[model samples]
Target: MKQKMIDVSIHLFDKKGFTETSIQEIVDELGVTKGTFYYYFTNKQELLTTIHLNFIEFLLKKQEEILQDEAKDSREKLRAMIYMVLQSINERKKSARIFFREMRNLGPKYLEQNVEKRDQFRKNLQQLVEEGIHKGEFQEDLHADMVTRGILGMTNWSYYWYNPEGDVSAEELTDIYVEILLNGINKSD
Candidate 1:
């Protein structure tokens, strides 16, 4: 029952902007009464917050696992992280859209919390890039923060057109991204 409510919330929030989506619409999608929603969440905002928190936690856990793996070096960890982003879209495609698209609707405090988590994620990626440069895997001139933001720009944009069921899988796309990311566009002298 709780899962269904969250699912309905995701769909409704994605289709209708968070401001446009009402508690009544979410409950109606679940075919439940208002009381049920109140029982699980105090209001629509709380429900959206809950969903965002869950998604953030999920991403953080994956990131921790990827970073902890010593079998692979920094480059592989970077690939894993990119793969995680694309995989997330495949697994919870609509959730990614809702999580990003509806963020402005979050209360200031809630928005700050989400921003903190997002910052941590970005820092982790930057650290991984730095490690790669130190190891000579990536060019020494590379700026960790710049590379991190570039990767985020590329990966997040995948939501615009990437279909998990379409021609490519997340793993395959990650392989392609890895090549472009670690290698430069310039021709080797």
Candidate 2:
């Protein structure tokens, strides 16, 4: 029941902005009573916070798994991370959209919690960049933190425009992004 509410809420939230979505709408969509919602969640904001926390926590766990793999190099780890996010866009499109778009709706306490997880995810990417630089896979002169941000910025923004059913596959998009990150798009005449 809790998961059902979350799934329906994610769809509604993705379609209608968080501020625009009412508890009545969510329960009506599920054909449940408001009491049902109150039984699980204290209020709509709590529901939103749960969605935010679950999304970031899930991503963080996946990221940690990718980073912990011993056989893959830093480049492979980076590619895997990009693919993970892109794949999420394909598999959990509504959830991803809500996660990115409605995050600001969370109150201060929830906002702080999600921010920490977000920062940890970014720091993991930064460390990966630093590792790549240390191993000479990436350019040494580049700022690791800035490059990390660039990689994240490019991939994260895909949720806004990427169509899972489009001609481009997630694997293909991952390749393009990884290539652009490692080797710029400039022609080397």
Candidate 3:
């Protein structure tokens, strides 16, 4: 029941925007009384916070698993991590949209908690970039923090425009992104 409300809310939030969506509308969509919603979530804001946490926590867990693998090395781990982000966008488009677009609607307490988790993810990626540099997999002078932000910025924004079923598959798009991130756009001699 809790999951149902969240799933429905994500669809509504994605299509209608958080501020525009109402608790009444969510209950109506669920064909349940407001009491039922109250039972599962304290209020609409709590539900939104839950949604935000679920999305980012899912991401952080997957990234941790990828980072822990010993055989992949920095480059493979990087590819897998980017691919994971793209795949999550592809697979959970509605939730991804809500997670990115509806974050501003969360209350101060909720926003701070979400930001901490988000920052941890960014720091973990920076660590990976530093690992790559240390092992000579990436450039020595690279600013890992900036590189981490650039990789995140480039991939995370794809939720707005990337088409999973269009001309390119997710794997193919991952290859293109990895190529660009690792090699850049400059022509080699």
TM-score of each: 0.92, 0.95, 0.97
Residues 38-106, model 1: lDDT tens digits = 999877777888888888789989999998999999878998899998888668878888887888888
Runs in model 2 deviating more than 4 A are none
Candidate 1's C-alpha runs over 4 A off are none
lDDT of each: 0.85, 0.89, 0.92
Give the true-structure RMSD of model 3.
0.9
How would you encode candidate 2's per-residue C-alpha lDDT over 1-189 as one tens digit per residue? 999999999988888889999999999999999999999999998999898888888888999999999999999999999999888766777878888888888888678988899899999989988998899988889888888888889988998899868999999999999898878899999
lDDT of 3 at 106: 89
Better of 2 and 3 by TM-score: 3
Better of 2 and 3 by lDDT: 3
Worst 10 residues of 2 by lDDT: 88-97
> Looking at candidate 3, what is the lDDT of residue 156?
95
Ranking by TM-score: 3, 2, 1
Residues 143-183 of candidate 3 have per-residue lDDT tens digits of: 99999999999889999999977999999989999999999
Q: Predict model 2's lDDT versus the native.
A: 0.89
Best by lDDT: 3
